[model samples]
Target: MIVITTPTGQIGQQVLERIVDSGKSVRVIARDPSRLPQRVRDRVEVFQGSHDDMDVVSKAFAGAESVLWLVPPNPQSGNSTEYYLNFTRPACQAIQSLGVKRVVGVSSLGRGFGRNAGILTAAFEMDALIESTGVSYRSLRMPYFMENMFHDLESIKSHGTFYMPTAGDQVLPLCATRDIASTAAALLLDESWSGQDSVPVVSPDSLTPNEMAHVLSEVLERPIRFQQVSIAEYKATLSRFGSEAWVKDYMDMVIAQNEGIYDDDLQKVQPSDTSFRTWCEEVFKPAVLAP
Candidate 1:
């Protein structure tokens, strides 16, 4: 049996669907099983609990051969590292105890760089804790998620302006969550490769914020301008939205992006065959037009 953590999330849902469609015995961990879709809940066994609970995680890992692990973001924690470690420690211990043969973990691209990458530092620490479990593990080091860009869809629809802290001309790596989910599912299903592999799942194309704006403009059939905001301005803007911790983390991530810290020398794994323009047309445009 294969076990999945946070199986109701954007990427997790896709992973769970792929696994279930393959006729595999699947188990999913969630704090509330009722939150899962009726289709998924019917196909897989649901373990109702959080990752931080050792007894719950241990029970979920029982009889599972492979696991897909994800560390959910904790914005309310006083220390992000501690919050991640709290989840990782128990999961790792459980994995060891249960003798799960393979694990595919979702981690960020810049984790290896440590504190030089700001909040990603916490992700790096989680990677360390998980790897120490001595299981055959593959860490999916993903680039900037295209899903993250959805945050600005409302602002773009309202004002025809997309704002970012990135330099308007800097081409940075970006990947769709669908691609990450597919790649992660493949890794979890295969069980061929072994210990401590960091895989970079990046898009084949890289684009600047201005270029992305042009694509959005074309997709929406309207004029859209890219407005690059200073770090301070970005922080102030996020603060106004009542997300102080997110503001700090996002500002730091922007700085890391500007410094090219997220630029890893690893080969990329391309999946989904979805381009930025296609994503804008199919996903973003539809969402903007909805309601």
Candidate 2:
């Protein structure tokens, strides 16, 4: 049996679908089983609880040979590092106790870069803690998600502008969650690999916000402009929706990305065939036009 955490999320849902299609016995951890799509819930066993709960996680791991682990984002935690560590500590212990042989963890691109990536520090810590479990693990070190662009969509549609802290000329690595999910599913199904390893899953082509805007404009048939915001302004904007600590970390990440601190070597893996333009035309465009 293969078990998955956070199965209701975008990547989690996709991975679950792929696993179901593969005809494997599957289990998922969810806080609310009713929230899962009925069709998916029908095909898999559901263990309802948070990842932070050791007893629940332990019970769910019974009879499972492999696991897909994901650390759900918690921007509101009083102590983010402690929260992640606390959640992973028990899960790791449970995985070790259950004798699960393989694990696929969802991690970010800046995981090993220390504090240079700000809020992503917790993710780095989580990766370290999970690796310490000594399971044959693959950490999917993912690039910035193309879905993040959705955060600016409403503003862009209303004001015709997309704002960012990075220079419009600078290109940064970006990947779709679907591609990441697909890769994770493939790893979960293949149990031949051993030892701890990190895989950088990134799009072959990196595009600037300006280039992305151009692509969106071509698809939407409306002019969309890219606007660079100062770090101060960016922080101020984020502060309205998040705590000062969280906003500071977020702004620091933008600064890091702008300075090319989180840039990764793309030669290790071939990019997916999905382009930003294709994503906009096929995914974003339809969503925007949806009634």
Candidate 3:
């Protein structure tokens, strides 16, 4: 059996779609099973609860050969690191006690940067805990997600601009959630590889925020500009909607990005298939045009 977590999320939903028809027994743990598509509900066994719940994961992991683990984001989280590990620790115990064969987890880049990168550091710690369980594991260490740009949809639609804490000319790798899902599904299906490893999932295009704006302009047929905001301003904006710890941690993450946390991995790999221009034309443009 293959157990999937966060099956209703962006990347997890795509992973479920790709593997549901592969003749593998699929089970999912969800807080609200009703959100699952009708087709998916009909096919997979549903365990209705958060994956962090020990009872929930212990039962869900039972008789499963492989599992796809993804920790859902919580902006109101108190301590970002503890928040991530809280969700992970239970699953780690279940992975060991249940005798699961393999685990494919969603993680981030900058694992060894030795800097406090907030959520990125949390992800690195999660990787370490999972590795300690000794289950054959693959952590998809992804870069900046192109889908993250959707958060700026209203700003882009109104002013033809996007904002970030980093410089407009700073180059960073971008990956689509689709690529991450595809990579996870491929790994889940193949049983040949084993042991703990990080699969750096990144796209070929290394573009600056300014270059991204240019691609968005061409794709949307409008001139869009990139604006570099102060980290304090970014923190202030986030603080209004998130916990104090969350705001501080995420601000630290943005600071790390500005300081080149993604640079090392960006220089090493570009395994993902999507590019900025292609994503702008195919994904971003359509969203911009949507009602």
**Best prediction by TM-score:** 3
Candidate 1 stretches with Cα past 4 Å from truth are 240-247, 266-272
Model 2 stretches with alpha carbons more than 4 Å out = 112-115
**Going through the candidates in order, what is the number of backbone clashes in each?**
0, 0, 0
Candidate 3 lDDT over residue span 85-112, tens digit each = 9999999999999999999999998887
- Candidate 3, residue 242: the lDDT equals 93
How far off is residue 81 in model 2, in Å? Answer: 2.5
lDDT of 2 by residue, 24-89 (tens): 899999998998989998999999898779889899888888889887876565455666788888
Cα RMSD for candidates in order: 2.0, 1.7, 0.9
Better of 1 and 2 by lDDT: 2
The 10-residue segment of model 3 with minimum total lDDT is 263-272
Tens digits of per-residue lDDT for model 1, 1-291: 899998988888889878888878899999888888898899898888897799988999998889998887655554566667887898888999889888998888876454555567667788888888888888888777788777788888899987877889998778888888888889878857887888877776778988988888899999999998888887876677644655566567678878776665434454446688888888888998998
Estimate the overall C-alpha local distance difference test score of candidate 2.
0.81
Candidates' C-alpha lDDT: 0.81, 0.81, 0.91
- Pick by TM-score: 1 or 3, better one: 3
- Candidate ranking (lDDT, best to worst): 3, 2, 1
Q: What's the lDDT of the predicted structure labeled candidate 1?
A: 0.81
TM-score: model 2 vs. ground truth: 0.94
- List TM-score per model, in order: 0.93, 0.94, 0.98
